[model samples]
Target: MLEGIRVLACGARDAVRLCATLLERAGAAVERTASDSADYDVILVSSDFDDANVVARWKTSGSHMVCDITATGPQDSRAGRRWSDAQIQAMSGLMDTTGFAHGAPVRIGVPLTEISAALYAAAAIAAAVRVKRMRGIVQNIDVTLSGCAASALTTFLPAAFARRAVGRLGNRHPACAPWNAYRTRDGWILICTGTEEQWRKLKQEARVPQLDDARFASLAERVRHVDELDALVESWTTTLTTDDCTRICESIGVAAGPIVGVRDLADEPNFRMRHAQAARAMKAHGVDADTYRDVSIFETSALSDALPVAKRAVPCERGANAAPLAGVKVIEIGQYTTAPLVGKHLAALGAQVVKIEPPGGEAARAWSPGQGGTSYFFALNNTDKETIALDLKQESARAYLRTLLKDADVLVENLRPGALAKLGFTREALGAINPRLVYCSISGFGMTSAYPSRPAFDTVIQAMGGLMDLTRADGAPVKIGASGADILGGQAALFAILARLAAREENAGAFIEISMQDVAAWCALFAAGNNSARGQALACLDGHIWMEREVSDAERAQCSALPKAVAAVKLAGATPVMRVDELLQDGDFLADVLSAARDANGAFWPVLKAPYRLTKTPACVRAAPGAPQAVRLAPPAPARAPVPEDRPA
Candidate 1:
C-alpha cells in the first residue's frame, strides 16, 4: 500500500496524465509539476518536450527516485555523468518511439512496450523509495522506449534476419513434408502429418493402399516425391469439399482442419472465448475514464486457486456523452481492405467519414458477391461513411483536396510509397495547410527501407515476413487463409490515429505513420517463438497426402450386404424392428449401418424404426404477390477533391 509515497509527474500531456493515474491507483498522492520539487518521493517525467529548464531544476534535488517516459535514449547529465534514479525514469517515454522508418524515424503503434516500461519505472521508484527510507541513499532508474522495444525483440529481429539474409522459405520446412494447405472442392484445409505414425494413419483412413507401396513407403521417400504426392492428394481433394476432406482426414488421426476466414473465426467457439477474455480485460482497464487509466495485473498464483476472484467492475460508458471526434471530420484517401477499414471503424464510432475514390471509384466497388448492386466492399468497410469521386492527379481535384483538408481533423492515405509526395501532398504541405491536423500515412513498408520504392501485397508480405515459414506444420509453408497482415495493419493505424488525436490536444500537429511490413514482422516473431521452442521448421504445401488403407475383402463384403437389406425394408414400407433395450444401448449401430449402406451403393440410407419420422419437401420456394422488392444500390461516386475551406487549423 503506497501510503507514505507521493509522485510528481512531468512530461507530455498524455504521459503526465498516465503517470498521475497510475500513481493515484497505487494510493499515492499525485501532483502535476513542470519542475521537480523537494517533497515528492518520486518524480516521473515525460520527455516529448525539448525544454531543459525542468531537468536543470531537478538536478539539485537528492534522495528521490526519478523516472523518465521519453522516446529519447537514456538520459545523461550535461556533465556526461549518470543522473539519479528519479532522473532516469523521466526519460522513458521518449525512447519508446525510436525505430526504423521508411523516410523518417517512425514510432510504433500503441506504444505498448512504452506503457509497460513506464509502469515498471513506477515499481522501481517505489522500491527505491523503500531503500532510501532504510539506508538514507536515493537511487535513480532509467527506462527508455527504445530499450523496452529492443528487449521486446525476443524473436522479431532474428526472424527478420532469417527471412532476408538467411534464405527464407515459404510454408515448407526443409525437413518435413505433407504438412500444408491443399485445395479441396469448395475451399482449403490445413493438413499436418508431422510423424510417420500419423502419416500412416492418414493414409489408412483415406483408403489409399498405394501410399504404403515401397516407392512412396517411407517418410524419406515421401519427402523426395512430395510434388507427386501433392498432385495426387489434390486430385482426390478435388472430388470432396473442404468439410468432407477435413472430416475424413481427422477421423483417422491426421492433424487437419479447414482454413477459416476472419468472419468464420469471429463466429468460432474458441475465438469467442478468447475475445470474451480480452473484452473483459479491456473493460477492467477503466477504458471509459475521461482521463488515462491502468489495467489490473493478473498473477499466476491467484489464477491457480480453486476459486479465482472475479474481475473488477468494467469502466462506465466511454462514448455515451458524444463522439470522441464529434466536431472532427475525416477524408479517407485509400482503397482495398487495409486503408479503408480505418475509416470504417472511425465511422462506426461516429466520426464523419468521407471516402474519396478515383474516377472509376475504388477497385473494391467492383469486387464480387454484391447485393442490391452494392459490393461487399461498399457494404462492409464503407458503412456509415459518405463517398465522393475525384482525380487527385488533376489540378482541379488536387485543389479541392487541399480545400477539404482545410476543415478536416484527420487525413488518411495509403498510396504507394512515394505517390503522396508526387501528388504534392507531402507532410510539410499538409501540415502547412492545417497545423492541427493529424496526418496518418499507411504504407506496405516504412519509408526508410531500401525497398521503400517497391510495392507489396498481403501475400508478398506474408511470404517475406516469415509468416509463411512458421505456418508450415511439417515442412511446407502455407498462407493463412485470411489477410491477417492487412487487417492487423489497419487496426494498428486506427490505434496510432487515436493516440495522435490525444497527443494533438497539446502537440496539435502530430504525424502518424504505420507500415504493414513491420506489423507482419511482429506477428511472425510471435509465431517463430512457438516454432523455435518445438525445434521444428515450417510446414510445406507440396508434400501433403491424405489416404487410407482398404478394409479386408471379407469385412467389405459383409459391410456391402447391409444396404440391400435396409433398402428392401424401405421398399416394403415395413416398420423396422428395434428393441427398447437396443435403443437405450450406448453403441453406434446406426453409424455402422449407414457406413455399410454407403459402401454398398455409394450413398447412405437409413431404415427408420418406430421412434423416428421423416418428411420431404420440394426445393423451390414460391414468392407471394406484393413481396418487397430487393433494393438495388447505386454505384458509389468517385472521391471528390477536398474543399480548401475544410482544412484543419
Candidate 2:
C-alpha cells in the first residue's frame, strides 16, 4: 500500500533486509543509505546503528514515518542496549513456555521476536503511511523485539494478574481431552475431539470398547484421565496408518490429522500440488530460488504490489467513536483461531463485528478451558462481537447470513477453502449484495490449488513448513508451544485487510487470500536469526538458557557460563535465557513492565501492552462477553453504495 514512498534504512543485515524487501514488494522505493530526498517517506534505524550524526540527519529529513527497531524500545529500562533474538525472547517470557515441561525451557526454533518486530514494524509503517496521506501526519514508531515477543503471548498474559502461572505446555493442551499426538502404524497422528458428539462418534466409528466406560464418558472425565484416554485411543490408532486413522476420525466428525514431519509435509499430495504451482509461477516470473533464498518462500501472489494507489482515498474509520476502525462493520463466518482472531482485532479497534455461528455455537465454544461452560478461548476471541446462530444445512440460515452481509464493510472466513463458494455464499452473490465489501479468506492453501479441500491444522503446517526439523536439537522436529501458524496467518489476514481498507476508496471490493502453510514457512525464517540455535538446553548461573545466534561465527560473539569461556569468546551478554516464572518471581520486575489491567468478572487480570499504538486513533477494547443473547442483525442496504471519498490527508 506504500507506492511512491521512499524508505531509507540502516540496521542489522537480517532486519534491514526483511524490512527493505517488504517495502520494495509493497511498491516503496528503498535505498540502503540515508540520502536526503525531497519526499523522504520512511526512515528505519536499527539499534545496532548508534551513530548519532546519521540518526539526527534521518530524523530531520522530514520523513512521514520513522521507526527504531530495538531490542527494547527507548521507554524500556533496558533500552539503548544491543540485543540478539535470544535475550529478547527470554526476557519477554516466550522462551520459558517453549518445549516440554520436563525439558528445560527452550527458545522457539524461529526468531519470532525479531520476525514479529519486523511484521509489526511493517504494519505500523503501513498505518502511518495511510495516516500521512489522509491527514498529513508524521509518526515516530519504536518497535522492540522484546515487546513484540511479549505481545505475541497476550493470550496467556491474563494468568499473570489472575495470580496464576503460565508454564510450559509441552504438546498436550491443559484444557482439552484427546488433544495430543498418538502413535500410528507408520507414524503419529493428532486427534482432537472437542464435543460430546465427536467423542461418541469416535467410540462408535473406531469401536473402542474402552470409551464405553463411565470414567471416559464425559469431556471433563476424559480430561481428568487424559493419560488413560490417550492410551485407549492410541490402542486403536496404533493399528492404523496415519492416513487411515485421520480419515476414520474425520469421517466420524472428530478433528484428526497426522503428526507430519518435514518430509511428510513436503511429500504430502496437497503440499506438492501447491509447490509445483509455486515453482511454475516463479519460473514464469523469471525469479529463481537460487537467486533469492530468504525472500523466495513468500508466495509469488503475496509479493505482488497490494495497494496501487498513491494517495489515501478512503475515509479513515474514525470520528467521535474514538476508535481507528469505528465505522467499519465486519461479518465473520468461520470457526477456529485463524478467522475469528481477525474479527477479534477489528472488534478491539471498535468495529461492529457480527460473528455467525451454528445452532450449537462455533466449535471453539466447546473446546474446554471453560468456566461454568463458557469457553475461555471463545471469550477471548469473540468478545464484543454480536453472535447469530445459524444452521447452514437449512436454507433459511444461509438466507439470514446474506442479510448480515448486506452492508458489511468486510467479510472474513476460513471455511475449508472452497466450501464457502459452494454453500450459496458465492462471490457473485456477495458482490451483488455488497459490492464495496473487502473479502478476506484464510485457508490452509490457496483456493485454486489442488489441495484446497483438504483439512489442515496448526501442527500439520508446522511439520510441513519445516519448523519441526528446525525447532530442536534432536532430529525429531516439534510443533511450537502455541499455534504459531494459525495466529500468524490470522495476522497476515488482518494486515491485508488494513491494506485494502487504505485503498478502499479506489477499489472498495478486494479479495485477500492467506495460507497457513505460507505463513508457517515465513515464520521459519525466525531460525535464520540463529543458524547455530539447536533449541538445546543450556545451563545458566541461576536457570536454563536458549540462544539465537548471529549468522556467521567470525563476526558475532557468543556467551558462555565459564569466565574462562567468556575470556575466550567475550561471553556474558544479557540474552533471554532464564525461565519466565523464575524471572517473574522478582517483585521489582513485576512492578516495572508495561501491562494492561483488565477487570474480568469480579477480579482484575493483567495483559501485556499492545505492541504498536496509534496516537490519533487508538485501539480500544470496549467490553467482554457477558450473557449470551439471541439478537437479529439489522438488514443491510439492498443497493450498492458509492465508495466513500477521503476527507483529509
Candidate 3:
C-alpha cells in the first residue's frame, strides 16, 4: 500500500531493522542512509543513533521523522542513560508479572519490547502519512518501548489501583481456573476457559465429577480453589496424550492447543497455511513474497481492483482545530482484546467509534471487576467508545448494521472466520453497502484456514504460534504473563487499517485480514533465529534484580553487597526488577505512561496513554464512557448522506 514511499532506516538496533522490514513488506522503498543529503518521505532514528545534525536536517526538509526513545520517561535515574529492552521491561513491571509465584521475576523469552516498539513505530509512520494527506502537514513522532510495556498492563492496573498485589502467577490466569498448561501423557497442552459454561462443558467432556462440585461451580469459587481445580483437570489430561487432550477440548468447543517451541513453527499447520496464503497473494500481484522479510505479519493489501497511489500535498501547518481523523466513523464488533483494542485506538485518534456487542454484552464485560464493579478488562479495551448491544441474530439488527455501514469509514471485528459472512455481511456485501468502508478482521487464524472450527484464545494462539515454546520458566514452557499474541495482533490490525486509510481517497472498500497466530509467529522470529535466552533474577543486598547476560562470580558478589537500585546502576548490564505495587508508588512512571479515566459509575481509574506521540495532530484520549446511557439507534439517512463528524477541543 506504500508503493512509492521512501523510508530511511538509519540504525543497527533490532527494532529499527524490524520497523524497516515491516515498511518494506508494505511495498516501501527502504534505504539505510545516515547522511542527510537526500530527503525521504519517512525517517526512523533509533535512540542509539547519535546524529542530531543529520536528524535535524531531515526534520527541516519536511520528512515524517520518528525518534525511538527507549522509554516514555527517563530510562534511568541517571541523566542521559540509555536502556536495552530487558532494562525497560525490568522497570515497566513486565518481568515481575511473569514466572512463578515462588520464583524471582524472569524476563520473557523473546524480544517482546523490541517487537512491540517496532509495531508501534510502523503504525505511527502510517498515521503520520495519513495526517499529512488529510491536513497537508508533516509530523514528528516519538515512540517508546516503555509505552508498549505499559500498554500490556491494562488489566493488571485495576488491581494495582485498588492496592491489590499484582505479582507472578506462573502460567495460571489470575481470574480464571483451569487456565494453565496441564501435563498430558506425552507433553503439555494449554487449556483456557473463562466462562462457567465452558468449564461445565470441559467437565462433561473429561468426565471429571470432581469439577462439578459446588466448590468449583462459580467463576470466583473456581479461582478460589484453583489449586484443587487444576489437580482435577490434570488427572484427566495425564491419562491421554497431548493430541488426545487437544482433540477432546476442541471437540467440546473449549480452547486448547499444544505447547510448542520456536523450532516447531515450520511444521505447525496454521503457521504454514498462513504463509502459503501470503505467498499466493503476493505472487498474484507479481511480487516475489519470499524476497520480503516477515511476510507472515506484514500482509498489507488493499484487496480491490487496483492499488491506489498515496496522496502527497504541500507541507502546511495543521490548523489548531484539526484532528487526524476527526471526520472518521468506526464500527467495532469485537469481544476480547484484538479488535476492541483497535477500536479504542481509533477513538483515541479522534474517530467516532460505536461498539456493537451482543444483547448480553461482550464476553469481556463479564470477566473481572476494575472500577466501580465494571469489568476492568472491558473498560480498558472499550474506552472512549459509544456502546450498544445488538442481537445480530435478528434480521432487524443485521439490517441496522447494514445501514450503519453505509456512513461508516471503518468496520473492525474479531469474530470467528465466517461468523459475519454467514450473517450476510461479507466483504462484497459491505462493499455494495458503502463502497468506501474499510473492513478489517482480526481472527485467531485467517479468514481462510485449515482448521476453521477450532476455538482460539490468547493462550491457545501463544501455544500454537511458538511464543509459548520460546518463553520458558524453570525449564518448562510458559505463556507470557500478558496477552502477547492479542496485543501484537491488535497493533498489527491498527497498522493495516491506518495504512489503508492513508490512501483511502482512491483505495476504498479494502479488506484487511489479520491472524493472531501469524502475528505471534512473526514476533518470535528474532528469538528463534538467535536462540534467545531468557533473563534471570539475581539476588542483591536489599532486593533482586534482573539480567539477561550471565553474571560472573565477582559480579554476583558485588551485586549481593549492594541494594537493587544501586546494584543495577553499578553493574554493567543489570536492571532493577519492579513489581506492580512498586511501580504504582513511582510518581514519574505513572505520570508518563498512564492517565485517569472515569469508569461506568463515574469513579476514576488508570488507563494507558496513546502509544504513539506525534508532534502535529497528536492522538488524545477523551474521558472513558461514564454511567450507562440509553442509546437509541437512528435509521439510515434516506439519501445516504455522509456521516457528520464530531470534533472535540
Candidate 4:
C-alpha cells in the first residue's frame, strides 16, 4: 500500500515499468526520474549495478528501500547478467518442468520470470517498509528474475522433496486425474472428478454400467490407470457440446466449465451483471446509455485509525525456526487458487492466517487429488492456516470478523466485486471499525473496472488478456499448462500485503486492490513494448537455446551478441531443446537436482527453495498445517491483543 510513500522509478525496461505500475496501483506515488534519490521513499534503478554501493548506503541510513532487479542473484556467478525471458527460461532448469512432455520445452507465453521477479522485488520493498517502521532497520531487497521463477516451482515440490522422480504432467496436474481439458462435440471443456463422490455423479450421468469396478474405486488406482480412465471419460465428453458438458456436469454436481475465449467474458453472468447495473443507472439519470463511459468502477473507501504501539515487540528475527514473517497475522476469506495461495504464501512464511470459510468449506477443498472430500492442493495451499466456518451472510458473522480485525495486520478476500461492500465491509466501513487494518481485494478484472461484474476465473483472465495467444507458437490460442493468471494474481496480492502491512502504523492503514486480468496483461509487456522502445520487435531467433553466463559490455554491444551467446552455450554440449520430462532422464540433471537437496532424519528432501536466501531471516515451511482450530469471537473491547498466532514458528 505505501499509500503516502513516493517511488523514484529509473529505467526504460518492461521490468521497471511493471514495478512502478504495481507500486502505483497499490497507492504509492511514483515519479519517473533519475534525479534526487534522497527525496523518495523507494528508489528503483534499472540495469545499473554500479549504483549498488549507493543503494546499499541508502538502505543502511534507514532512509529508503533500494531494490536491484536483474537476471541473477547477487551471490550467483552470473550477477550483472542480461537476458531475455526466453533465454532465462531456457537455462533455468524450470523450463524443463513446463510445456508438453514430448514437445518442444517452451517458455510460459509471458515474461513470467521478469514479472515474477518484479513481484518479488515489490514485496521485498514492502517488507523493507515493515522492517523500517517496526524495527527501525532498513533492509535491502535484491531480486533476480531467474531466482523468482525457480521459487514458483512449488508445484514440483511434492515429488522433488520426497526423493522421488518427477517430470512434466502436461495439462494433467500430478495431484489429480481428469483435472484437465477434454474435447467435446463443439469445443473443449475443463472438468474434474477429484473425489469418489464426484466420479459417482459422472457415472450417474454416463449411465455407464460396471464403473464400480474394484480397479477404479480409489484415487491411486485411477491415477495409475489414468490412460484407460481418460478413455472412458472421452467416450462421454466427445458426445456432448461444450455447453452440454458443463450443463450435465453441473446437473450431476461435478466440477466443470466450458473452455471459452476472452471475448466471451462479456456474455458471462459476471460482466452481464455490470451491463444490467449500468443500464439501470442510466435509466435513473434519464440519459442515453451509449452517451456515457461505463460507470463500472465501483466506489471504494479508506481510513486512518490510531493504534497504540503496544510494548509487545515480537522479535523480528529469523529465530531458530527460520520464519521471516514469524509475527505476521493474516485473516482471509477465499474460495479458490488465487486468494488461497496468497494466504498460503504468508502461512509458509510463518504468518498465522485465519481462513474464514463456509460451513461446507471452500470449493477448492473438493478439487482433484482429494481424499475423503478434501483436495491435496487445498490442503497444501491452506497449510499453516486456521479455518473457521462462518456464514458471512449472517450479521453475527460480520460482527465476529470485525472483532478479529482489531489487531490483525491484514485481511484478504476474493469474492465477486461489491460482495464485501454489500456485506457492510467496505474500505471505509472496515477502516472506521479497525483503522490499522490493511484490506486487500483480489478480483478478476478489478474492484472497479469497466467489466467490474465479469467473472475473473484463471482461464478467463488468460484468454481475455491474450496469454493463451502468446503461448501457442504455431496453432490457435491455447491455455498454458499452469494456472498462471491465478498464480500471478495471488502473487500480486501477496506483494500488496507486504506494503500495506508496512504502511500500517499507529494511525494509518491502506486499501489495496489487485486485478487478475491486469496481472495477466503484465506478462506480455516485453513482447508488446519492445517494438516501441527499439523500433523493432524482439526476436528470439530459434526460441530454444539460451546462455546462463554473464554478458560483458563488449559482447552486449555486438549485433551478433544473442547468436554469440547461443553459440557459447551450444559449445558446451548442453541439451538446449530438451522437454521438461526429458530432464528427469538425464543422469547429470538428476544428480544436480540431488545435489541441491538436504537430508532430514536420513531422508533426502528437496525444498522449493527461493533464489536469494535471507542471511539472517530466511523463510521456511516449518510444518504441515493440520485441521484448523476455531476461535470464539464477539463484540470488540478497548483492550487490543495480537491475533492468536500460536504456531511452530
- Which lDDT tens digits does candidate 1 get at residues 1-649? 3556777776553334544564565457887754433487777765445345665455346545656555434332222222211122112211111211111111122323434344434434443443344334554555444333222221122222223221222323334567555778886665767678777776666555566667567778887877777666666777889778866875665655555432232232322332344334334541233311212111001111223233212111233233334455888998876777677655544467777788767765654444333343344455546677777777777777888887787788888766878999876687667665667777765544435434455554554444454443233345532344565566556655543343211444546666665555444433322221121111112110111123345533443345423522333221112211222231332321111111122332222111110011001111101111222233456899977686677
The reply for model 3, stretches above 4 Å from the true place, is 34-37, 60-64, 72-79, 208-218, 277-294, 298-321, 366-368, 531-534, 540-543, 552-563, 569-572, 598-603, 627-649
Tens digit per residue, CA lDDT, model 4, 171-215: 565656656567789876767666778777787787655456776
Question: Model-by-model lDDT, in order?
Answer: 0.46, 0.62, 0.76, 0.60
Cα error, residue 474 of model 4, in Å, equals 5.7
Of 1 and 2, the candidate ahead on lDDT is 2
Most lDDT-accurate candidate: 3
Best by TM-score: 3
Write the residue-wise lDDT of candidate 3 on 85-129 in tens digits: 777778888888877778777778777888888888888788777
* Model with the higher TM-score, candidate 1 or 2: 2
Model 3 scores what on Cα lDDT?
A: 0.76
* TM-score of each model, in listed order: 0.38, 0.77, 0.88, 0.65
**What lDDT does candidate 2 reach at residue 2?**
61
Q: Which ten residues in a row have the lowest lDDT in candidate 2?
A: 295-304
What candidate 1 gets wrong by more than 4 Å, as runs, is 1-320, 530-649
Point out where model 4 deviates above 4 Å.
36-38, 46-63, 133-136, 175-177, 183-187, 196-328, 332-340, 344-406, 413-466, 473-483, 504-518, 521-568, 571-649
